[model samples]
Target: MNNIVEAKGLVKSYGDFKALNDIDLTIPSGAISGLIGPNGAGKTTALKSLIGLCDVEGELQVAGRDPRTSRHKLMEDVCFIADVGM
Candidate 1:
């Protein structure tokens, strides 16, 4: 199956604090997945990057378009709602 979301060497930082580093992930089409981790594990940062709500380094593609440049296009085909972590 083709990947619906892809990230390689993904990195996100806030000033000098690095939240994510070299995170590689792939999600196949029509697959159910979840990001599970403790707090401060960069789950939120990774999600933000995937949804194009945060700028990130490295390669990222959602729906075959780069989230940084084609966020509008991506959003046209995607929707995300962020809620407090349970």
Candidate 2:
């Protein structure tokens, strides 16, 4: 099956702290998934990156499009309910 979301070597840093470190994620198409972790565990940061609300290093693709460049188009197909989504 194809992936609805794919990320490789994802990283997000805040000042000197690394919120996300070399993260690799994959969500298969038509699958329901969630991120679960304690506070400050980069859950929010990951969501922010996935939804195109924040910028991070590495390659990421959602709905077969890069969230950094094709965010407007990606939003049309993917729905993320969090921070800004609320």
Candidate 3:
């Protein structure tokens, strides 16, 4: 399957704290993928980058578009649901 999400050498830092570094990942189209890690593993950061809520360094793509550049266009396709009711 073609990759729907791709990130290479992703790096994010706040002040002196590095939240992510040199991370590479790929998610193919029509595939089910899961992210598992302990807290502060940058899972939320990565997702936030995908949705363009946060600015990050390195290459990041969603549906073949840059979330940073095409945030307004891509945001419509993303849904955020609260888990409080679950």
Q: What value of lDDT does candidate 3 attain over all alpha carbons?
A: 0.84
lDDT of 1 by residue, 8-77 (tens): 9999888888889899999998898889999889999999899788899999999999989999999999
Query: Could you give me the TM-score of model 1 versus the true structure?
Result: 0.91
TM-score of 2: 0.92
- For model 2, which pairs clash? none
Q: Write candidate 3's Cα lDDT for 5-71 as tens digits.
A: 9999999998887888888999988888777899888877777888888899999989878999999
Segments in model 2 whose C-alpha atoms lie over 4 Å from true places: 83-86
Q: How far is candidate 3 from the true structure (C-alpha RMSD, Å)?
A: 2.6
Clashes of 3: 0
Off by over 4 Å in 3: 82-86
**Residue 9 error, candidate 3, Å:** 0.6
Candidate 2 differs from the real structure by a C-alpha RMSD in angstroms, to one decimal, of 1.6
Summing lDDT over every window of 10 consecutive residues in candidate 2, give the lowest-scoring window.
Answer: 77-86
By the lDDT metric, which is better: model 1 or model 3? 1
Better of 1 and 3 by TM-score: 1
TM-score of each: 0.91, 0.92, 0.86
In order of TM-score, best first, we have 2, 1, 3
